[model samples]
Target: MNKYIVKMLSVNDNNAFFQLINTNRERLEDFFAGTVLRTKTIADTINYCEEIEQKINKKSYFPYLILEKESNVIVGFIDVKNIDWNIPKAELGAFIDSKHEGKGIITTTMASLIDDIVNEHHFKKLLCRISSRNTRSIRVALNSGFELEGTIRCDYKTTKGEIVDLNYYGKIF
Candidate 1:
């Protein structure tokens, strides 16, 4: 198994985070539209990290970074946002650096993180809304124990300005 260190996204990670997105820009553009658009430079990343830190403090958004254990490089990100505390559920989003694709990093990290999200946050369910065309992400979701629920029509807009359908998958705790 690939070793990793997962932790909350901290403001201190701005540089590494920016580099991760910079290197994976093309591959992340579609699924991570907002992130790809917001983190165009180190300055932008610093600002974004500050905002995310505030949200984390408010318990409104949870963003976690996955680092390669040996090198301490930021290789993947997982977000639990759109949290509805009444139902205690949140939306799940994730992306891995292109170079780390096919390495099972996301599947393993996400599975372990899901357990923590449930135990620490009291989240009842987690949903992943994946672009319909993104087979890689769908595979990761399924491998991480999510079930396909349904297709959401025109669920997301890409940074390139195209509206796309999404496949909704869910995992109940």
Candidate 2:
């Protein structure tokens, strides 16, 4: 019944964007332990913001910053990636502040992002890949109307020199 999501439309709040990514990087590092996903330094984070800015400029990606209402802090974010106009499919990615894990913040944020993107964008399908070991992410995808497609065996290099399989999920717009 309350608004739990807001897109990063105005560029006036540069601090907000940096703050969100800086505070959650550690949690992201852990969540994506098997992959090189986190921004280890401020420069990297800045570069990321710049990259996101470029993506937005090109209309190739749309990102949203998720703010937890009571706390007024960005506890998580959901992004639509790999947007392909021809295929009408976009890859999905999400992250939540570790402190807020197990809560439904990501779900709420996801619902909001999906609704807006579906209404504004013409993409016909959404695609998501979840590390096989990350059950929480898989659950979120399944609960959010995503259907499990198949498992890709030994598809990626994870941390500690381990290979991980990824489960694919898809949904129609």
Candidate 3:
């Protein structure tokens, strides 16, 4: 496997991260629907990054930027959101640049972070809510050991405003 690194999203990563998102905007929108970002300019990306950074500081969300270790280029991201301290569970969302999609980067990165997410963050359950039509993402979640839980009907709206069902997958630590 190629070496990769996962770091908490930071102010310093704005440019690289923005470029990655902008380049993959269309592909990302296909799967992410409601969550896919549509950043038209650098300022928009900076604002988005700053919001995520604040959430990280407040412990309400954790968003990590994935990079190629050799070049330190932004390749993807995995985020843990909807953190519930009482239930000790969080939702996991991830995506990789289309160019890097088939290399197993996301699966490996998620596996690598499981330990830290469970031990350091104290999350008992990690959930992945994937669009039912997104086979690639479902495969990634399964490869990382997340089990199919159930389907959420009309869970989200697509970029084009179509309602879709979501496949829920979870990993219990």
Candidate 4:
């Protein structure tokens, strides 16, 4: 049996989804400011989930909830955003529950999703923009078959109001 199941984010996932973001707000605030800041309440999560569904239907963003099969809880999330249909590429983003970190769950799940992103989604390339200081995520990108493309200086300001460089990693399918 699969250890994890990846389901598209839906409105019904509001509660568990909010809990996941709330539980890791501190850890995610630095790099994942958009989600951490936007989803501060269950109501906020409901709105965000609705927005995600709209984006999915518009073919602009695809977000998946990673469910741990045994516990049936949301253990992580993966997203394909910034899609450029012309280039047929998208940027990938992901975060795992703090409790489930370093268990190879994100790595394995990402590897599998890479296949789907290419074969099923018909994406020509996938990209991951990771903070220069986040070695864990850089390793995840490398281990999942992405190569360092370049670095963007002062990519964006974090929720803490600190600017950080982002390392661009990409895999061409």
Candidate 5:
């Protein structure tokens, strides 16, 4: 396993948060399609950080930054968004730094997060939605014990200018 750690986001981590967004903008755009991030400047990251702070404070959404143990630099992220505490489920998404791709960072972070959420928070399941065309992402999902349930067509618009489908994967605890 990699020498990395995952922790919850804090309001005071402003600089670190911004750096993660700035540093991974291109990688994010590549993994996440239909991003209007090209038009948004760094100020956009500032605003997003503010918004995320409020959400974390309220417990409605949970986000984490992945840090390399040696450098303490954020090299990836794992987000469990739109959580319904009563429902015991969350929408999961993650991406490692492009330079660090294929290093099992996302997999380790995800497995660790799921263990925490299920054991500490009593979560019953974690679900992920991956664009069908993204074989790499789908591989991560499957590698982390997520089972393919189904697909939603036209779920997202790709960078290549086509509406693509998404596959739903789930892991039950």
Candidate 6:
């Protein structure tokens, strides 16, 4: 098994977070859309980190950095955002650096986090909205116990301005 750890994103993680996103920019653009495209400069990253810190304090979003245990390297990110307190649910998003892809690290990490989010965080449901073209992410969601709810046609506009369908998967606790 791969050794992995997941922790809440912190302001002090700015450098490691910037490096992770910078190195994975090209690959991340394939699915991340507007989010990753905005962080081209270190200043942009610092601003983004500050935004995340604010969200954390407000309890509006929870972003976590996925790290390799042995090397303590930032290999990926998994976040639960768009939190709705009334519904007590959130949307899930994740990406692994291309260099770290195909290692089952995200699967392990998410599986563990799901439990914490549901029990500790008291979220009643969690959902993942994935690009239909992203089969790997769909599989990861399924493997992590999210059931396919449905697909929304032309739901996402890529950074390149192309419209794409999205697969919605969810788990209800």
Which residue segments of model 1 deviate by more than 4 Å?
Answer: none
Q: Positional deviation of 120 in candidate 5, in angstroms? A: 2.3
Q: Which stretches of candidate 4 lie over 4 Å from their true place?
A: none
Tens-place lDDT per residue, model 4, 1-173, is: 56998888899999999999999999988877888877999999999999888988898989988999888999999999999999899999999999999998889899888887799888989999999999999999999999999999999798788988999999998
For candidate 1, write residues 74-101 as lDDT tens digits: 9999999999999999999999888889
- How many residue pairs clash in all the candidates, one count each? 0, 1, 0, 0, 0, 0
Better of 1 and 2 by TM-score: 1
Q: What clash count does candidate 5 reach?
A: 0
lDDT of 6: 0.88
User: TM-scores, in order shown?
Assistant: 0.96, 0.83, 0.93, 0.96, 0.86, 0.95
TM-score of 1: 0.96
Candidate 3 per-residue C-alpha lDDT over 37-116 given as tens digits, one digit per residue, 9 for 90 to 100 = 63567887778778778888899989888999999998999888889999899998999988898999999999888888
Pairs of colliding residues, candidate 2? 34-159
Q: Per-residue lDDT of 1-173 in model 2, one digit per residue for the tens?
A: 75465666334434565566667655555434521253455555556667777888887987677886776767667777789988777988888777778988787778767877878787799988888989899989998999999999988775555788999999997
- Give the distance in Å from residue 43's predicted Cα in candidate 3 to where it truly belongs: 1.0
Worst window of 10 by summed lDDT in candidate 2? 30-39
Q: How many residue-pair clashes does candidate 2 contain? A: 1
* Deviation from native of the Cα of residue 49 in model 5, angstroms: 1.8
Locate the minimum summed-lDDT window of 10 residues in model 4: 29-38
Give RMSD (Å) of candidate 3 vs. truth: 1.6
Better of 1 and 3 by TM-score: 1
lDDT of 2 at 76: 69
In angstroms, the error of model 2 at 69 is 3.0
